[model samples]
Target: MKYVQLGNSGLIVSKLAFGAMTFGYGNIPSVYKVGQDQSQELVDRALAAGINFFDTADAYADGQSEEMLGRLLGARRKETVIATKAGNRMGPGLVQSGLSRKHLFDACDASLARLNTDYIDLYIVHKTDPFTPLEETLGALNDLVRQGKARYIGYSNWPAWMAAQAVQIQHERRWATFINGQMYYSLVGRDIEHDTVPFMNNCGVGLTVWSPLAGGFLSGKYTRDNLSDPNNRLSGFDFLPLDKEWGFTVLDAVREIAQNHSATPAQVSLAWLLSQSHVCSVLVGSSKPSQLDDNLSAVDLQLTSEETAKLNELTRPVPLYPNWFTTMTLDGRVVEALK
Candidate 1:
């Protein structure tokens, strides 16, 4: 139910964004099996619980995610902030994908029709298109805002350096720059901390965490002996690469903290991310209503400083290159002036 301004923008968004990624049976049948009836129930529950921000993508479930979300929201479409992405291949043809001016322009119009909305609250570049010129992508996105097709634009799953360059280009052109980002950040995956986190912090961009559960790895259902569950998405998708041994070590601590708070390990894992200042919202794309309810309750689970410290220290990403070099060379800000 808590809200904050999305990145640098004035538009307020819920701290927990309901992702419709699992709302339909498409390419990823195992994960996206929640049909219309169940999707309706889940969407209703999320809205009733005060979630006003919904996220989907043109690529998710082969665009069925967007369609189902549109149908589910129905008359309440205007009441929520709808975000969708392009640049991911929605079809087999070369012209059907990429961030080229041709593909992006056609993609936006297609997304609008699928979502059944006039303008997207936040339109995003789902993935990088290396073959396309950066200017072509940036200019096309700027045009989306200018034409009222999209109100804001952002990037997901992009490298920190590439994101910075895009921002520079957008700023130089006096166009709309990315105010928010959707990145894979979870208790099990802290890789973004080495670079992306600092980049977003300095750039004043808000972050919405995707795969906050590490593709269900942190659900506490998997143990050292039982690594794969046929019923879980990890068995099929297995996308987010993780250090399993390290994950178990962190999960042990998460379980203890969850026990102390009378909560589930999943909620504790989400609460750890929610406690982070840089995280504007955490996407919950659970197929099961019970699981979604569990995730929604995470906003209320406040971990103690001691608990938060334990989890942070356990899952902290090791400093890389200049990050380590810079920290090793800090000086002058000792106890002199303040004392």
Candidate 2:
């Protein structure tokens, strides 16, 4: 139940955010589980465990995630912080998508109605909206804050440069700025280490990591040989683009550490993220109570410094372009070897 500041904002949020992406079903949603009753039970358990942040998206389950979250929150909605995303296509029409003022306004109202709440604690842009100008998107988001539709703003699945541009636009126009980052970060997928993580820390934005387990690969479910059956989401969706060879290498290191610590691979994977200084919160979604409990246990799991260094060595990314040049060129305060 540890808490941290949400980006630069003064508001404190739980380290583990309840992800409601699995709250719906049917043809539109690629991955959906836990119906209303089940979702309600999970919500209760999460709240009991001191998780006050809940995240969902309009496109999930065709707006079912929002509906379910709102219904479950009911009278206790004010006790928790609710965050949902926009900018994804909600319908087949041309105007039903992007960051246009029309879509932004309509989407917020729709989310508000669905959630049965007047205002959202944090509203995020789900992805880059190339069709709309950044200024237009920022203006619309600013209007939402003024109208009390949303209290704060955030962005997800955006590149470092795009995020920087958005922040610049906000600064120049005095528009609502993004206070947090909701991005895919995991022990197995260390791609964000190249740019996103550094940029986020520089901008003083809190990071709420999604897919901290690399879609169950770090959950200790699939191994080199055991991955034969392609039934699970990772096998079926093939999302987050995990590097199997590199992933297995990291998992071998994780196995040794987990054995020494008497923890699960999943727990070690999550603890690895929690150990990072820039990570403000980790978004975790589960279908069962047991799964949620196991995930929650990560907040208490502590990896020794030696274990962390070994994990980092196995998963560290190859520096790309300017990063290589910059590190090679920068002269900073260096410690001399003690003779």
The best candidate by lDDT is: 1
Writing each residue's lDDT as its tens digit, candidate 1 over 239-262 gives 777778878998899999999999
For 41-129, candidate 2 gives per-residue lDDT tens digits of 89999999999999999988889999999999889898899999999889989999999999999999999999999999999999998
Clash-forming residue pairs, model 2: 7-206
By how many angstroms RMSD does model 2 differ from the true structure?
2.1
Number of clashes in model 1? 0
How many clashes show up in model 2? Answer: 1
Candidate 2: stretches off by over 4 Å = 28-30, 332-339
- Please give the TM-score that candidate 2 achieves against the real structure: 0.95
| CA lDDT, candidate 2, residue 239 | 57
